[model samples]
Target: MGKKLLVLGASGNTGQHLVKQALERDHHVTALVRDPAKIEIKHDKLSVEKCDVFNKEEMRPHLENAEVVLSCLGFPLQRKEPVPYYLQVAQVLSETMHEFGKRRVVFMHSWYTHPESRARCRGFFLKNFFLPYVIGQSLNGMRLSEEYLDSTDHLDYTCIQPAHLLDGPVTDKKFILNETDSCIADAAQEINRADVARYMLDVIDDESSYRKIRAIGVGVDVTDKAILTDDNHSYVPNCPIRISRADVARYMLDVIDDEGSYRKIRAMGIEGDDSYMAVIMEQIDEFKKVIFRN
Candidate 1:
């Protein structure tokens, strides 16, 4: 059966792609965007609602009874101060989802503010001059937002923390997912926004993806079928994943469970530094057959 969803930040770069795909897949989509008429999504399966996320009352009607919610919201890049808007929206959304008994959420986040994990891929500049400015001027509110979510026991949430996002063409390569750092690699890695949408939806109902955070890399297609394992550490390479492999594999039977690394591996059909992440979940399903076959 097709499920219904309330997608926040539908006007955003990633959210736009996600909303389109959801409608294409025949899911009933309610887009809570700041502007209703401004959205170019011309799908019959889609509906748009105008909302200011900070206004909890205004957004409540939109959030009510939605099966799942994906938050693709963020602050502008030029801002030299804290991003209070994001924190307010996230906190309210969390409570709203909890109150409505709709706990599924996939949140977009950056690795900069997530000091808890080691995915901090330091660029030459961020490590040098920009770090102080970033911490002092930009990162505080996001970190607080994360802290709020961390403390919120209300909903089942998943936060996707991405590395330095550089704009480039999609390589149609596969994207990797694991709490482990082993998958991290190459080319000023930024996930194709479309691909991030793909992962968010596919994993939305998977129990393992609930309350889980994944750090991914810009990927290249790997058809060799070689499975790499990083036993050195779990989730983020150095930082251990709180869960075990038995749990991850059980949640999404299609993925290859690398207990050695405690990370989930799947090919997004994207190959190269720039990736389209378009192959869908075909590769992972094939691996599942090999691994889980009796």
Candidate 2:
């Protein structure tokens, strides 16, 4: 049974994965973008619509046709606006969905939105400076959007929050999920955008996930050598610094692929650079030993 979904921000990094994966699963997707030309894929099941997402009238027709709404909207880092680009879209979507009696909606948010999660950052630089300086406006917008969603009791909404996003293909390992505010994986700071999309679709219709905030990260364990320290001068142990965008897509699909994952945040990632380097060193050492022994 393929459901009809309306995806906002379909041209974005994560949005692209959502649109593609939904088609792979046989779901009919109406990708709403400012520029339909940005969508490169042409599929019978996928319809690209060009429209202003901030206008309720413009979104009404699409909202009426959708069984689920997935928003992967993001703001550019360099944008100097005090508010995020997606805040208005969020408002419009919420209003339109309610007017049309649509209940299922899922939003893509960052783990930084959680105060407790932000406080958990390993060092002074990341906690006190870097994150705030770089993405503070985007964070504020997401937080405000979440707050707006929370005020509405009629919409069955789930906000998928992931750690730092990475770009890459899906990995062999599964992503981890947590229902709480904090990510369950130790020192896990990044996830694939694809996995985030996968998780959103997976729980789109699950009743348990409705009105819940889920935090996700990649499942790969970070060993000691790979852990990096921040300005606080403390080693952040077992941290996989990033995950691939493809893996994020895979995790999102896996969640949709399985019913049990409903209402849980799925963390997706691969091994960090330091961990990979360590493995390479071990291999070289083994090769040296073999040559000397011979």
Candidate 3:
């Protein structure tokens, strides 16, 4: 049976995919949004709850039937909204979940938030500048939100960290899962928002992921199969690659269970420094196999 869900930030880029994919998988979803119109998709199994996270009364009723909570809440980079929205949402959700006795919660975070983990910010410009400068303001809230999530004792929470998100189709590359410390390789690593959402919902029923932080990134194995260069050239096949939303959504919903993923902060990506053209060669072999089989 599909689980009931209370999804915050369902209107955002990644949240939309969560909503869509969850419903597609027949999970009952109650999307908590400030405006119902923001949710462009509609389905019989999906319900849109109009409420602000700050309004406890308005939000309480939506929490009544939900078995799990998924939060992708965060403000846009262009607007630095005061009031520490991440922290506030964390507090509210914590209280609400405790009140309803719901335990499992999945949160959207970033690869940059846990620098102390295995993730290393490669490149001098990214480490010395972009990490600290371009996203400094937003990082504060992510850091605080993570602290709150980690400190809370009542909920079984998982903070999902994905590298840069881009719009594209999903590919055949398997997501590289690692501990928070080991998952991220470069500041340039990117994945699709759909892929992130796919992963978040895929683990909704996973009792093992409780109280863990996970980082998801593109794998070095499939980089060449999908990425195109500036001149429409495919980059040398073995580079770290970006993923597609369609592929992510498909994979997450289709993934089978694995006990190794339980209660651990797993990083998903390829290992080593130079991953050139290997993915291309693999794909060619796969194509050849298909042709020969026919």
On lDDT, the candidate that comes out on top is 2
Off by over 4 Å in 2: 78-84, 182-187, 222-294
lDDT for each residue of candidate 2 in 1-294, tens digit (9 for 90 to 100):
999999988999999999998998899999999898899999999999998888888889999999999998886552244356656777788888888888898988887675566777764545665555556557777878888888888889888888878777655446677777645545357677777777787887789999987777776553322113233323333434334445555555655767666654534344465453454455455444433442
Estimate TM-scores for all models.
0.66, 0.73, 0.71
Cα-based lDDT for every prediction: 0.62, 0.73, 0.70
Better of 1 and 2 by lDDT: 2
Candidate 1 regions with alpha-carbon error over 4 angstroms:
77-81, 116-120, 131-138, 166-172, 178-188, 220-294
Query: Residues 233-289, candidate 3, lDDT per residue (tens digit)?
Result: 433344444344444344344334645444534322233343545544554454444
Number of the candidate with higher TM-score, 1 or 2: 2
Candidate 2 similarity to native, TM-score: 0.73
Candidate 1 at residue 124, lDDT?
A: 41
- Backbone steric clashes in candidate 2, count: 20
